[model samples]
Target: MNATLVAVVLSLFSAVAYAAAAVAQERLASRTSDSGVVRLLGSGAWWWSVTLNGSAALLHVAALKYGPLTLVQPLGALTLVAAVPLGARVAGRRVSAVEWRGTALTLAGLAALLVTASGPAPDDVLSVPEALAVAGITAAVIGALSRPGTRPGLRHATASGLASGVASALTQTVTVAATDRSGPLLSAQVIGVALLVAAFAAGGLLLAQTAYRGGLGAPLAVVTLANPVAAAIIGLALLGEGLRGGAAGLLLALAGATVAARGVVTLSRPVPEPAQLPTKEPEEHPIAAELSEEEHPVAAVLALNPQSASYEPVLIPRQPAPAHLTPL
Candidate 1:
């Protein structure tokens, strides 16, 4: 079989594995409130998700070995394509039309972005200093985004993407070294880079899992888009892979990014009001419940009966002031 054909087959299966992993992560996230690493590691389901992710990563690496970057990278967008429907099925919900639209937009935009961004497979590896710089920068970015904030899931997804991208870059260095028999395997440099790669990869997985706590579609899309873009940025900066098609390519890339961003925004939008079930009425406060309608009609009305109203104020009987309580 042609290597390209093998790569195609591997990429497709890799996408499926990745999609399944996302679904598993999302389901676990929905069931658990805590996204703590310790809590996640303890769960059988979470570990299963991690297994699926590892399988996907292995398949992806195999696919790359068999094919070119341009072919393999675009195929990766299929993870989002697979994830939307897969996540909906797992959650026992129908895929909303809005989700479909968002998915389409995201895929189309990502395709454009990948087409322009991907060039020849980069052979260059990061120097020790460069690797350290990349690791430090990626860590800082992930830390900043993972902090408590609005759109926590999206923030975490972006962090996940950045971490994954850096890991990919670092992995390239280690893989290249391993492939070249001329160099001694297990050198200190290789060991150090490999460790960095492992750290970032683990961090990425944790962040991706946390991203799913908000819901599935938007966070997944964000991760999908951000990952390649981050890697491409590194490639352009360090590996001599320039954006294709010159100025036109740059314009197209920007447009694609905008469209993808719009799609993510669409996916993140709250469900239509009509589809949401009415929320339960708030429980009465204990003090409010203790007030009687007659004795404290106003308080009772305000707390227990929104429709009722009274102007009368409760009158306390005048009692002789205690010596200490008297006005100075």
Candidate 2:
């Protein structure tokens, strides 16, 4: 098959893996009172999530073989497209029209971006010092925010997402840089990139787990957005790929992306309302102290009170029973 066909097939598989992984995360989120992240990561769902994510990564590398890394990496963002609808379907959620609008905007932006990504390859290679600096900076940020004292899952997720993006950028750089060159990436650069990818991915997953504390939407959104932006930057800086039509196209794509991000922000925008336990205020008392007026008459009391709520009075009612058994 042609490379474009290959890329398309790979992207589809990537989407499927992401969709399944998201479903697993959502399941874990529903089961927990706090964020499902930590517990779910330790549960069966976590393993499922890992499996799906691994599939996406595998497909991603496969797609890279056919398309430019710049072309292929950005498409990884499609995982969200598959994930959102699948998430809602699996959760039995009916998203509001506004959420749909937001999703549409995001899709438009992504489409615009892919179309405008035409360009010749630029340089491939990061000096060891630069890679080290990036990795250190990203790692430090993740370590600081992920400390025990930080805010709950959403915040941790947001912080972790940024780190994950850096990891992806470093990883793709390594992947692309070593694609055709090098005797073996058992060399220092490959090893360094692998370490970088591991650190970021591990941290990101932990953060994503944290983010799901409330629901799956927010943290996942952060990761989705951050990963693409980071990859795009690396695609440009390290790979020499650029917007097809220069400044104007880049500007339009930027505008579209901004709109898309706004849509996601809107979709996952935190609601201010505190979650309320089922309110008991309006419900009738389970066992009312005072009987209703209808129960005032002896006859009514006897009739309305089901056997479940009746007391024997210790004075056997003057009623007859069948011969087989008698009340004690």
Candidate 3:
């Protein structure tokens, strides 16, 4: 088979594997409230998800070896495309119309973003200072996002993407260094950067697993879009890479990002609950009812701020009883 054909096939398989892994992770997240690494390691489904993820990573690496970054990276966006429907099926439901539209928009935007962002690999490895700077910034961002009162699934997903993207950048540096003919294998710089890559990659995985707790489609799409965008920024800033097509490409990239962001927002929004049945009117003072199970928005907000002590039940002022009312 031609090298390009092999790469295309491998990329497709990689995307599928990633989608399947995402589905498994989402189910596992839903099944358990605990986010501890030790608890997740004990779950069979989590292990299965890990296996699928590892397989996808191997396939992605193989695809890169045989194909251009522009082609392979754009194809990686297919994971979101594949994941939406697959997740729906696993949940025993059809894909919602909004989900379909969001998935389509996300896929389209990411394809454009990846195509424009990809360029030749950097010639030089990241220096220790540069690597440390990148790591520090990523860690800080993640810490802020993980703090109480942030959005639950979405913030975690964004953090996951940041970590994964940084890891990709660091991995690129290590790969380039190791492959250089003049450079000795296992050089100090390469070793240091490789350790950073491992740390970031593992952190990304845990964050991704956490992100799946809410739902599948939106979180996955965010991660998919954020990963490449973050990596491309690092490439542009630190690695001497340039966007394709100059000014026009930058405009297109921005447009694509807007579209993708809109899509993610749509996906993240919970489906509206059906109208509630009218209840009998209460006499005099009535205690405000607690949030119902169907109040998804309130529940989501509470989930984001689990430890907040400020919430209080609303109380209605007492009113005089009607003169015509009969005593029960």
Q: Which has the greatest lDDT?
A: 1
The ten-residue window of minimal lDDT in model 2 covers 295-304
- The reply for model 3, stretches above 4 Å from the true place, is 1-12, 62-76, 148-151, 267-328
Candidate numbers, best TM-score first, in rank order: 2, 1, 3
Task: For each candidate in the order shown, give its overall lDDT on alpha carbons.
Answer: 0.76, 0.66, 0.75
lDDT of 1 at 188: 75
C-alpha positional error of residue 279 in candidate 2 after TM-score superposition, expressed in Å: 13
Q: Over the stretch 66-116, how does candidate 3's per-residue lDDT look in tens digits?
A: 544444555666787787678668767777888788777877776676656
What is the full ranking by lDDT, best candidate first? 1, 3, 2
lDDT of predicted model 2: 0.66
Measured on C-alpha atoms, candidate 1 has an lDDT of 0.76
Model 1 pairs in collision? none
Largest TM-score belongs to which candidate? 2
Off-target runs (Cα >4 Å) in candidate 1 are 1-9, 64-75, 148-152, 270-328
Q: Candidate 2, residues 75-174: lDDT per residue as tens digits? A: 6556666667787687576665666777787778767766676443333656578788777876676778778767666567667667766765666556
